[model samples]
Target: MTKIFFLGECMVELRELDDATMGQSFAGDVYNSAVYMKRCYPKLAVAMITAIGRDRLSEKMLSRFNSEDLDTQFVFQHPSKVSGMYFIETDSAGERRFTYWRNDSAAKKVVQFLNDDVVEQLTSADMLFFSGIPLAIIEQDSRVAFWQKLEHLKLAGVKLVFDPNYRAQLWANKADAIEQFNKAFQISDIALPGIEDLNVLYGISSAAEAIDFFQQYQLEELVIKDGPKSVVTLTGTDLQSHKIIPVTNVVDTTSAGDAFNGVYLGARLSGRTVSEAVQLGAKAAGTVIQHPGAIAPLAAFKQAMSEAGL
Candidate 1:
């Protein structure tokens, strides 16, 4: 079995059900991808690598992981801190607005749990995936340690996938985000970057500029995504553009990019062609955007996958 580890946070989510109602759930960037990937290819060994607190909400989080079929071997528990929480407000158009209270979340100290044995386990994995959210949230010294481990894993032939899931609030300044994202791009084998996110960080407005910017990095595969537009992919010297079938009835745009990242990587790792993977990703994103949250209903996503022949 091919083992892949996803390194990030899993926060408690509170979303508005209506003016006087709310619903609670658990989700984060890499956590969403890990769950969707496992659902897409159940035989693949999928693991979640992060820390949670010993609290009621943390217990719920762990249960969610188990129910989603994500491996919990690398999920550590902290004594004092608790999991982070965020509130979401959706407009009439289903666009999401977020308010976060995650400054001292247990996952911030996740690197403290990355002792030698954990590092060794990650190195033995077939792939490791993360995003700019984790890069921005972790402390600087701990990030140094984590990057060292990522380098070691890269040297051991573990494919490193990075998604620059940028949020302006998570980072202090654009310069720091650029510096940290550069380090991530340097060590990554596959990079899934949304051009809109990069526009804020790099002043890049179009896929051409984004692709040219990535020319500096020695990436095996690079994907530049723009919502409802053609996606651009670069592998070696071959570049291809894929037009996404626009979803006219988008309910929520929260997990569109995450869905694409999950199914595309899942398909590629399962020996599908890049075109096939992109098709699956696009179909999955179309379905997810028509739903209402970051993690869509399992049956809906699987049905989309089946429709796409994923």
Candidate 2:
């Protein structure tokens, strides 16, 4: 079985349930992807790498992971620190906004606590995945060390998949974000970036210009997602565009992109063609947008794939 590792934080998510209540769940960019991927490909070994506290919430999170059948050997536990938390506020249109309280999260200490055993586990993975948010949360020195480890892993023939899930609030300044994202692109074998995120981060103005910007990295594969519009893909010198699966009722767009990344990568790793993978991704995203929160139930994803004949 192929071993896939996702590196990031899983935060306690709070969303308004009613006029006087909030609903709680666990979610994060890569964590959401990990869940969907595990659901999509049960035979594959899916694992998460991050630091979490021994708090009750963290315990609940681990229990959920176990129920999902995700490998938890790589999850590190901190003695005193707790996991991060985020609150969601949706507009009348069901578009989501977030407020975070994660500066002191245990996941920020991942690099500080990585050991030789952890490095070996990462190096042995068939695919190692992470997002821009993980880069933003860790300390500067740890970021350097983390990237260095990634470089070593790349040389050892481990495939690297990077999702530039850029959030301006998570970054200190645009320049630093650009620098770090560029460095990540250089080391990545595959990149999943949203055109809107790229335009906002680099002032590229147009999708063509944004594609050109990423082309400088000479990645093996690239997927540029444009919300409700077409998705563009690049393989070597070839480029193609695929339309998004139309969503009739979008309840919340919280995890649409993450769902797309998960299904697309899962399909490709399962030997599906890029076009097939993209279509599966679009279908999954369309299904996810019709639900609330950062993770739709596993059954929802399975049903989406079945309905799409994937």
What are the root-mean-square deviations of the candidates from the true structure over C-alphas?
1.0, 1.2
TM-score of each: 0.98, 0.97
TM-score of 2: 0.97
**Over all chains combined, what TM-score does candidate 1 have?**
0.98
Cα miss at 174, model 2 (Å)? 1.1
lDDT of 1 by residue, 1-310 (tens): 9889999999999987878998999989999889889999999998999999999999999999999999999999999989999998777777889999997799999999999887887887999999998898888789889899899899989999999988888888988999999999999999999988899888999999998999999999998898888789999998999988899987888888888888889989999988888888888888888988899998888887887785
The numbered model that scores best in TM-score is 1
- Badly placed stretches (over 4 Å) of model 2 are none
Tens digits of per-residue lDDT, candidate 2, 1-310, equal 8989999999999998899998999999898888888888888899999989999999998888888888999888889988999999877677999999997799999887776667876788999999999998898878778888888889888999999989889888989898899999999999998877887888766558868788678689999888878788988877988877578898899989998998899988999988999998898888888888998876776887888886
| Highest-scoring model, lDDT | 1
Give the runs in model 1 whose Cα sits over 4 Å from its true position. Answer: none
Q: For model 2, which pairs clash? A: none
Instruction: Judge candidate 1 against the unseen true structure and give its global Cα lDDT, from 0 to 1.
Output: 0.90
